[model samples]
Target: MPAEWEPHEGTWLSWPRREGISFPGRYDAVPALWRAMVTTLATGEHVYVNVGDEAQEAEVRAVLFGHEAVARTALDASAATSLATTVRGDRVSLHDRVSLHRIPTDEPWCRDHGPTFLVRDGELTLIDWRYNAWGGKYPPYDRDDAVPSRIAELLGVRAFHPGIVLEGGAIDVNGRGTVLTTESCLLNPNRNPSLGRAEIEAYLREYLNAPHVVWLGAGIAGDDTDGHVDDLTRFVAPRTVVTAVEADPADVNYGPLRENLHRLRAAHDQDGRSLEVVELPMPGAVEWEGQRLPASYANFYVGNEAVLVPTFAHDNDAVALDVLRRCFPGRRAVGIDATALVWGLGAFHCATQQQPLAVHT
Candidate 1:
């Protein structure tokens, strides 16, 4: 798989359905948050939005129009100055940078459900790993599970199906032949019971074109996906990984996080080179409706020239941005408030997937 930090022709997102498990009570407020991400991303690249049908697409156009109006009204003189060439009063016009698709999905977690685009030998192919709705936690997820192959059909891209189950969020890769994943998610019998450690590792390497696989212990708390690596550790550089560290020992996450950190420190790359591990401080516990939602700085999304970090109205938001900025010196690290988004058990990265720029011969 191509490194997420690499330039993208666009990003793909599945619009949240009212019937989906995410944002159960607050569907109205969720669209604006998505619009915020859409607007930011549309400023630079194409945004392919998945809708249920033409009717839903019509609804989406209206929503985008409302968002654009509100955004223009809220912009200050400086911000307004930056947006000089504004869209005229065309109904259902937000930014003309979207390619709407009628791809039906049960939920809006695109990173896990969508295709993992990989580039090899100057060709782009969609790696469609079997998605079992995070170990069948959410039933009737047949639509989401079928999304990868559907996307390949939509874009006319060749797709390679490995047959074994895998979710995009469960693995992190450095464009340079190395991958990081968690045993908690991959080894779970709910996902692939027949596959052992060596077997699963082989599939990952072959499918991702990755030569090395670094296995971590577990993921953070309350992540319903069993244990997605995106919520724990991420690859910032080829030999560098930025992982979350829990400071409070009394917290349940402390032990698992510390163990993962220790594992990462002792871990080496494919060439047996010592891996450089950077410890990122975790945010304080964020609970809502008597449940601890998975909130971590590690779930940030890497966009073209911008790293959108998930900020939880915490002081460490700045700290996380600083660390990521150093790691991605060429990209602008901006934080988006994910307090409400994580109630859905995901943030920016989970909601988006990159459509890599294809090399033209």
Candidate 2:
């Protein structure tokens, strides 16, 4: 398997359509978030967006055109700026390193459905894990399930089918030998009820080439997909993890999050070293129609030169940005107002996938 820390050739994103789960009457906001994220990523690396047709691609071009920001202004601006000029025609050019693809996909959460590329012994390979629309939360997911294979075909690479249901959001790799995940998401009866925790861990080790599997108990309240680890914790570096925490014991996530913290503290890495844990505050509960949304700051996506964090326009946005800035010293931490975006129950990381540069022998 390729090292998870390898530099990405570009990131993949699927344009949000009007008709999809979590996207009823909120298509504009969702695409706007996608535009912002793609623009921000263009500043640092390449971005490949999957558009359904020419019409959608034209609309996307117009949106990106309106967001172009000069390099100097971007540095001084505290608020997010769009790099509109970089996107033209069907291609959004960013310093010759960035490229955009108009591939067709049914849903927008490509990170969960896209191919997990790995490099082994100077050879590039792909891990095509089965994606069942978050444990069949949505059906007829034939399109989403085929995305990884399509990407692998485009890259002319070999893809290995793990045959088990898994989403990229459920696992975090340390680029060495450790992978972190939550039992609530992986072992949930909805996903793979037949497989035990140990069995699932065995699968991860065999496919991801992981030597150690650290399990967290559950996810926070209001997460629809049982407990995706991306929304609760992330590996900032090998042996270092940033996890969400609720200071108030009365908060709904207090117990579950604290339990995960305890496990992480007791867990050891491949080297048997205790994990370095950083606590990030969860965005205040955001409820829509009596339903709480999964609003978490730990769902931030790491780009080539920046980290795109989902901000809820809450009082904690600045604090979350600062925490991420500390975790990624040299990389800029830009916040995308995800208040409107989360209505669909996903954020930046959930919507984007990274393609590592092809390794050479």
The most accurate candidate by lDDT is 1
Q: Identify the leading candidate in terms of TM-score.
A: 1
Q: 11-80, model 2: which lDDT tens digit per residue?
A: 8888877776668877765666776777677767778877777887777766655444433222224544
C-alpha lDDT (0 to 100) for residue 336 of candidate 1? 67
lDDT computed for candidate 1: 0.83
Q: How does model 1 score by TM-score?
A: 0.93
Write down the worst ten-residue block by lDDT for model 1: 72-81
Model 2 RMSD in Å is 3.2
lDDT of 1 by residue, 18-111 (tens): 7788888977767766765676566567889999988778888777654434343323333333332433343223456777888999999999
Lowest summed lDDT across 10 adjacent residues in model 2 is found at 67-76
Q: After superposition, how far is residue 309 of candidate 1 from its true place, in Å?
A: 0.9
Q: Report the C-alpha displacement of residue 291, candidate 2, in angstroms.
A: 1.1
User: Alpha-carbon error at 256 in model 1, in Å?
Assistant: 0.7
Candidate 1 residue pairs that clash: none
State model 2's lDDT.
Answer: 0.79
Please give the distance, in angstroms, between residue 333's alpha carbon in candidate 1 and its true position after superposition.
Answer: 1.4
